[model samples]
Target: MAASPTTGRGRPDSLDHMIRLTSLTRRYGRTTAVHDLTLTVRSGHVTGFLGPNGAGKSTTLRMILGLTAPTSGTVTVDGVRFRDRPRGLRHVGALLDAADVQGGRGAEAHLRALARSNGIPRSRVDATLREVGLAGVARRRVGGFSLGMRQRLGIAAALLGDPPVVLFDEPFNGLDPEGVRWVRGLFRELAGQGRTVFVSSHLMSEMEHCVDRLVVIGRGRLLADQSLAEFAATSGGSTVSVRTPQEGALTARLTAEGGVVRAEDDGTVTVTGLSAARVGDLAAAHRIPVHELVTRTPSLEQAFMALTATSVEHRAGEVAR
Candidate 1:
């Protein structure tokens, strides 16, 4: 599948914000599924929502879509909750569960029924089917469709309204590599159109390319709400690697300059909080033989893992309260 069509003016600002959640929470009896969560899905960008399994990602999305009522906070779309209007769904589009499709109905038939219920024209159904690369399978029974095809159909159904805001929860699951790439391009195209594209995925690598900004949650709290660059900036500096035949001498010199040097088994010393050039100057001043000196920045995944290690550790076996 290729990318979907880009709508340059998809989100009309005068219509109000697409979605807003303030101090939102959901309690399941004694367990709190989502706790004091607050986030904003803005227009003109794709926001990645991430958390480990049982980390309240689903609970928070459900509350935003008005499927599950929040225990204590508010979720408002276009400044109104979905329940407040007879046709509240008109302002937004959503594909919360890929498996929620009607198995008995044909893909086109199901879409037609949904479109009719929402007072959308029948012509829009074909347009949406084509948009999601499901035109060939539109008339087939949904029961026979593979999970990837079903996901495409679900996305098509969400686009039927041509709504300003789109919310997809774990839209990439069960997709092949090609399908994943297709979906990533689709998300980028959608955001390019100025629609508020909010998607939830457990795969951070996928989000790294698909989203313009990230709203990461750990143990049901916002860990970060930043652009990719800002997240990288705050994650910290790079590691300086120095390869020297005189490992002991180089390590001693580095340590003397307040640099923490860890001697690797490969005879290279890894220095922290110091630049490679500075290390080279220090080595030259001390007459240490330097074979190689380089600085390697941490990747986004590495930075995220390091920053959230404590949160992840604390949430282990806790079942997300």
Candidate 2:
């Protein structure tokens, strides 16, 4: 699927980054999960936090929500330290993992407890459950919920706060294709309403169609911070396909013009590097008959793999240890 425009290059200057990490670091004994990472998640956009397995995405989010203290640096919400603000959580609603929900309580009871703690009306509990398509199952024990249903229930709890910023970590893990589409639409609608929606996932292919801006990390280090279009342009170059009646003549001409040419089993030559117009011009100049010409755009998933290949952490040692 083609990626739709998520940002129009008019990034707001509100310092309004709903979430910011300044030189954030987290260490687990000898291993550093996140290494002096710094990033800003602006409002009115959905920022995709992408990385490979064990890339410290979950750790960074834990620090941001104050679930775990950063060994160095700081994480803040609206310029206030995550741990220092009295109402630190009032500005952010997060779903770090499906299991974050209490297994002992019913889904409705869980949401009600949070609502009461935050001084939100009881009516909001039902509203959020229904909003997440969990109204029918809201009364069921959370321990009985499927992973996808649990993810939706978690999202319901996050929305219960009605906070300006929402953070989701691998929300699509067990969801079917339709559920993934639903979550994508929900994030877009939230961002459209001028809220900050930050999500993290190891699946770069799915995110290519889901997120606006991307903050990609590998080996616990920042790799690329860019919009989808910019990343595609840098790593996803275009490929040109050409066809001519005289395959041999066209192949010779294209090769001489610095174009990479490969003849298919059928009688046609595919050329790359030269545009269709340039190829046509060359063919016209060489008196070669042109039958067909086209260009195929590369997928964002391919671009992501090409860009992050070198930065991936080798986990062979960890498994052996």
Candidate 3:
């Protein structure tokens, strides 16, 4: 899969693996749901869309699928508007809300209907159900299905078209550990196959494990569109942990070398403003016998909170008691 550059304009040769939004703004009366959002979701990686409550994630996704018309600007899948493309399922597969399915319909029946609507073949229905591990319960009524089961059913429906672009909104909401693991692997697998996999999730931990890129929004505006490593690096780099017998000497040496050293309760010292390799090289240069030398990565949740602190529309701490 090719990694497309984030160019300002023009749809390049990577048409099949790009989802671009340009000056996309959606206003409902006095409320602007999405405002002038512009970014590209490239292929070959799972891109996670993150935002606090009322950040317009769902609205933006709806616009991408042509479910809601933008008040101004444009959104395109494969360099063409979703509205202009008929049989849309053939291009993009999305699981916005798992509970949107008809309660009275059977799992297989529901998928069959979607396939028919998209002019997809009936053969895809069973195959997708099997892929989502719902083939055994294909005849079960959606109303009787558990939340996790319904989620799987919804995933099957999205994949029924075998589309190149896949979008998932809060996919970890109703999944068990096994299901979560499966979905994680599935997203990576899809991206590995050159498909554009975009996911919106509040599970920061899960996002850290699965996605390598991030698109963060707050209050209907694009806050950050960067790779996961780059986004996390905004908070600061990693800290290095060192365990040595010569604590005073090492501390003085590290501080003298411009590394911020902090004494830990675990009888070890943590050094920031420098990497593990630097710390190790410094210790070796000073003849310090280091027992433990490791680097701790930055926390994604902490970084996200810092970036979107003011942009949070619904603040829990400000609620009236």
Candidate 4:
């Protein structure tokens, strides 16, 4: 039986290792787009590269692909620099900008040209187009393609070489809900096959569902590098919700026990710094009738906001009057 198109053939040797960045820095005149950033994108996991606008996400990606020169340090994939590799596309496939393609040629023709340049087979062009759901319009001129179609074309180009390491910068920008879900599943499938998938997006909600690891940066500097679960746990612990007829007593007891308690409009109390078991035990001891009790973990959006509060480049109402 043939392997599914979604699942590339067995993991290639070229993707057996990780991508390493050592003291990577890029400066453009007086502005530093990327600071001394040392990080690793491990294989078999989907890593989300997150940062605010002007936070250097694109610059870092460009440097990784060897499209832009770094001012200092180095970025290496599988023990070889991208620019130094004889066939770089075979090792690393990236979708940096959707609009970077030739507008005059058809989608299939454009991808065939790229495949030819990178020593990829001609048949892979149509295969990738089908994989990206662009086979129906493969012969249409790219000049009239919508932003979403262009994005799919870019992703097709990235997969043309069947590279082990894939990088996508804001790939979900112009996609609809179905497209978003498809891309999400595609990333997971790619990573499941022991490939390194690094995606950059400003949508915390999207990354929360798709990414296993996160690499957050601000002002060109690395801020947090951790798994999604670790980030949520360390930034702010879970909050316990409690509802009782004796709100005053529960609040007082929780507050006295060093738990930050806030009463909600619906007569429920939100307590932090205390576990649900502890709250229930306390209520039992104090004879407080509990109607509802639940623990809620902080959402990824909340955690990201808390983590990047200090790293934001633009703040609302900061303009001069």
TM-score each candidate: 0.85, 0.85, 0.89, 0.95
Whose TM-score is greatest here?
4
- Judged by whole-model lDDT over C-alpha atoms, candidate 3 comes out at 0.87
Q: For residues 39-140, could you state the per-residue lDDT of candidate 3 as single tens digits?
A: 999988899999999999999999999999999999998889988977988888999999998999999999999899999988888778777888788888
RMSD after CA superposition, every candidate: 3.6, 5.3, 6.0, 2.6
- The top-ranked prediction according to lDDT is 4
lDDT of 2 at 76: 87
Candidate 1 lDDT: 0.80
**Alpha-carbon runs more than 4 Å astray in model 2:** 1-17, 264-272, 314-321
What candidate 3 gets wrong by more than 4 Å, as runs, is 1-15, 319-321
Residue 237 lDDT in candidate 1: 62
lDDT of prediction 2: 0.79
User: Residue pairs in steric clash, candidate 2?
Assistant: none
TM-score between candidate 2 and the true structure: 0.85
Candidate 1 Cα errors over 4 Å, as ranges = 1-18, 232-237, 244-246, 265-267, 276-295, 310-321
Point out the worst 10-residue segment of candidate 1 by lDDT.
Answer: 7-16
Q: Sort by lDDT, best first.
A: 4, 3, 1, 2
Poorest 10 consecutive residues by lDDT, candidate 3: 1-10
